[model samples]
Target: MIDVKIFQTPSGEYTGFQMSGHAGYAEYGQDIVCAAVSALVINAINSIDQYTEDAFENSVDPDSGSVFFQITDRPVSTSSQLLLKSLVLGLNGIQDEYGKKHIKIRLEKQEG
Candidate 1:
């Protein structure tokens, strides 16, 4: 399963997200679930890089099926947040279609 962890600040700010694990629903390149999730996440990251000045820290390990990301210091730009929201929307759609067995979405709140 693709474990996606969404972060939120105590003040209600969108802190960023982390995605790890593989759906294993199909073969490597032939996995629709993996493809859909990858597209949504990569597009959002690219959009943030293109449309905003806010910097984020991220890492991707294809071998381990891990992608981790979080804000550096500054608040995330509105465009980035919007794109992230859109990513969530796409993820939700996938979860709805394929069920949670393949894609797991988690929300984690920060204390401070």
Candidate 2:
């Protein structure tokens, strides 16, 4: 099971993402989930032509059966938004539990 959260600026400019969950087939494991999320994030970053560097900021284990991923970077265009949505949807579709998990994408602008 994996939970994903995406944050975007109000002007629809910058975006960030956080994903956490279990990776293994029988039991949810952080190692598997971390690797999978890492790959997904990398692929997403590569899909955008304008993005120079999009990488994971941190991966922490606050407890057992849980891992965290923080991805931050600029997206080139609206296409980038659509690409992220699709990527998240695809990741969630991997399992039935994932389908039931809650995923959030929020858009907000930078404060002056």
Candidate 3:
């Protein structure tokens, strides 16, 4: 299972999430799993724009297996919060056939 956390910062909001619980064959080719996970994350972030006007700037740390999403020069609103929740939950559904699972999301808002 993956654990996700979202937190707020002075600059912007961020989502910190991680995945675990893959053993044996599922653990053999982690690179592929990472790639798939990254893709799913990117897609979910992109989907947020459809629900809100805020544009998202994202970075994936392959080394730490963490993904960060920030709003670039946009006003944050209640809609943005809702969108964020939806985005994370959507990505959590992505799974691998090797018993590797992706789940959990943490979101934080940054104080201006």
Candidate 4:
């Protein structure tokens, strides 16, 4: 299963996210669940990089099916938060469709 954790403050602001593991819904190249998750994650990272002034740290490992992204800049920008929220929405939609057996979404509370 694909495990996605969204880090947020008690006030419901996004801080970071970590995604790991493969859905194994199908063969490597044919797993739609993995593809959807990857697309949302990569897009969010790229959007934050290109459109927002927010600084962040990220690591990606395709071989191990892991991706981690966190805002390094204090007080995440509105644009960055919006992009991350969009990502969460997309991920939730995928989870809703594929079920927890294939994808899992977890919200982790953080001290802001």
- For lDDT, the strongest prediction is 4
Which scores higher on TM-score, 2 or 4? 4
TM-score of 4: 0.97
What's the CA RMSD of model 1 in angstroms? Answer: 1.4
Q: What's the lDDT for candidate 3?
A: 0.53
Per candidate, the number of residue pairs that clash is: 0, 5, 14, 0
Structure candidate 1, residue pairs in collision: none
lDDT of 2 at 69: 32
16-76, model 1: which lDDT tens digit per residue?
Answer: 7899888888999999999999998888888877887888899999887798877665566
| TM-score ranking from best candidate downward | 4, 1, 3, 2
Position 44, candidate 1: lDDT: 82
Candidate 3, 1-112: lDDT as tens digits? 4555555555654333334332222464555544555566566566666766766576666555656566664456667656655555555454324343344344546454
Q: By TM-score, who's the top model here?
A: 4
Steric clash pairs (candidate 4): none
Stretches > 4 Å off in candidate 1: none
Residue-level lDDT of model 2, residues 1-112, one tens digit each, is 4455655555654355555555443443445444555567657756643453455454555353233333444443466666666666655655333334332223334421
What local lDDT score does residue 18 receive in model 4, on the 0 to 100 scale? 94
Clash number for model 2?
5
Regions more than 4 Å wrong, model 4: none
- lDDT tens digits, residues 1-112, model 4? 9998999989899988998999999999999889889999999999999999998899999998999999988688999989998999999999889899999999999988
